[model samples]
Target: MSDIFNQVDNSIYSNAMTFLRVPLVMDPIAAEADIAVLGLPFDIATSGRSGARMGPTAIRQASINLAWEGKHFPWKFNLLKKSKVIDAGDLVYSTGDAAEFTQKVEKAATQLLASGKTLVSLGGDHFVTLPLLRAHHQKFGEMALIHFDAHTDTYDNGSAYDHGTMFYHAPNEGLIDPQKSVQIGIRTVFNEANHGFNVIDAPQANDMSVEQISTLIKEKVQGMPVYVTFDIDCLDPAFAPGTGTPVCGGLSTDKILKILRTLTDINIVGMDVVEVAPAYDNSEITALAAATIALELMHLWTVQNKQV
Candidate 1:
């Protein structure tokens, strides 16, 4: 009999649902893959709408639309050819228990990092980044954060498990250096008094050229290990209406892509794309956007490795 698991199946509609049609290997270390894709499917911490729990499935399914593009455009080489990438599937945890979710995610991440695999995560909500940061910090020490969102996620008044408060706790835990961090596309209200992070608000980001924006980001992070977290609500509701707690007047998808494309040299060690709730989406655009951004991140990793 032929080895069915090793057979190539790139059909857009008929195949096992893995991100970008990559092999689904639950044990990434044993497979000796360079990149591991993991999903966090818990959104109990969301303060607004709840369907972000379904985000992982939506994002993976939408990635089928991008499977046919071997080189992913503009980029000079094929991503999967340059590096071995596999979907490790979603994190399994006790439903509705926030503490358990945190423990499981951090432990899983630590294991993957210890095995020397670059992790690309898909979020259930923005809260997931805290544990992810904890795992990355243990392996790489303190990191510079590159956050893309409509909110700073720095609210000090929220409960222990709120999604809007991860950054507030992350700095306190010494997982990231706030002074070395940059928060982009923020339009919502946040304390300006002592937030520490360099804020490039929505209006400011729109006014600046992509080169200027990329330069500012590189200056802030400056040779430190970087962790990039993109909250889908950073895009205006017109571009990503499927997210919970979306604000108006945010960055356009085109502009964000341009900025990301220019940052191929930054030392990004880990990344995640969050808040893609498909129930509110029109024509699957939000999930597709998330998938494309995730793929771009992989290309960034591939290019960085090539440079090294």
Candidate 2:
């Protein structure tokens, strides 16, 4: 009808103002935001694999195609869209010192939390979650964790800030309470015999069904503020082959989504997705999975906050 509306391609371009269409800010204005995503690209010290340092960029590139369905998201419940989420880029890390890197991550996370915004973190490794959680605990204190992974990640502080020890190390730091924490999709083989951390593995419980695990998560995290962390290696390599440490017998992408979706009632204060190494991914499937989970977490946060 009008030249301004001339032959638009809705199939390729839906909305210009959606989150995916905006320019990714390296240093976004922190104070006036609803949700802030900061990347921590320092997985160099990871004992499992070192490629996770590239995870943030891969997830960012994969997120460019994210769409806004407004209220009717086909993947999950129609989450309210009142939330404002933005990428705040990666924090600087020291290659030499683990403690220094942890401090830097804590600083960035603290700044974002002070803004009263939810932190959707793109991680360097699972170890980065420790620093992020350290900041959240500073403000909230003793939040429950909904950890998704193949291994327990509770290895005693072996040497330094590596991927295998964040869960164990956090509790020792009083950042996470092991009794209140809930871990899902935990497969064996990476246990005490394999030099892994000591965590209560729910997937090993009776019948090991998604419903069973979901119920356990609900029961464990009830009435407690929650932090949800997703490790790409948590999924079987068939679904997420790009992680630095690809583990077998892990949860499927669909299974992980189902568990997270059912936990919508918990107060999800912060979130992180890590260990996605694009270098090993031939089909870009791992990045896609990570990006999709990020959007799902955003939806859950938005719905809970009534932002949609």
Candidate 3:
């Protein structure tokens, strides 16, 4: 049955489930692919809703809707053909244990990075990026961050496991250089006096053209290895209502795509799409948006690697 399916194009509803129908390899270190997709399916750190733990499954299922397209539009080449990508399934850990989850994620990510493969993770919440960042920092010292979210995730008042304080921990741990990092689509109130990251709030981002925004991002992270983390709440609630903490004023799906398309020249080393909670979603729009964004990130990676 598997061999027969391999001989034909997978229908949108058929075949083994993976991101963009990519092969599934459980062991990341042993996977012989240039890109490895890992799912972080734990969301205990959210201060609002709890369903983002299901984000990986929803995003992968929604990605099948995009698999039918041989070549994603606005780009001239086929992504899978240009790059060897595989879904490494989800990271397993003790249920509801945040410490175990973080340790496992960092260890797995570290192993994957050491084995010479780039990682694109699917998050349970924004906090997942913290562990991934730790792994990336070990591999590529002091990288710049390109963050997309309505909240800055830089609060100093939250607990160690809070999703709202990853950035606060990131900078203090030296995982990312705040001066070189750029946070886009932030609409929440944060302490500007001590916020070292170059922030382009929602209103500011909306006023600027995609060219201007992309240029600013490139300028901020130009000379450093970059890691991009996108939270679904970065989009306006109308565009992505399936997130735990949806903000009213946020960037549109189209605008975010345009900005990502313009960032092909940067040294992006790793990336993740987080905070997609399908329970609040209408017609799977949020998951689809995330899937599309993840696909665009892959294209961007391909461009940086000169695969296209």
By TM-score, the best candidate is 3
lDDT of 3 at 261: 96
Per-residue lDDT tens digits of candidate 2, residues 33-64?
Answer: 68887777777657765788888877876665
- Cα RMSD of all models vs. native, in order, equals 1.6, 4.2, 1.3
Best model number under lDDT: 3
By summed lDDT, the worst window of 10 consecutive residues in model 3 runs over 1-10
Which of 2 and 3 is ahead in TM-score?
A: 3
List the candidates ranked by lDDT, beginning with the highest: 3, 1, 2
Ranking by TM-score: 3, 1, 2
Residue runs of model 3 more than 4 Å from their true location after superposition: 1-9
Tell me how far the alpha carbon of residue 106 in candidate 2 is from the true structure, in angstroms, after superposition: 0.2
lDDT of 3 by residue, 1-308 (tens): 68855586567776637899888887769878889999999889999988999999999999999988889998999988889899999999998899999999999999999998999999899999999999999989999999999999999898889999999999999999999999999999999998899999999999999999999999899989999999999999999999999989899999999999999999999999999999999999999999999999999999999657
**TM-score winner, 1 or 3:** 3
TM-score of candidate 1 versus the correct structure, residues matched by position: 0.97
Q: Assess each prediction's global lDDT (C-alpha) against the native.
A: 0.92, 0.74, 0.93
Q: In candidate 1, where is summed lDDT lowest over 10 consecutive residues?
A: 1-10
Worst 10 residues of 2 by lDDT: 9-18
Report lDDT (Cα) of residue 8, candidate 1: 74
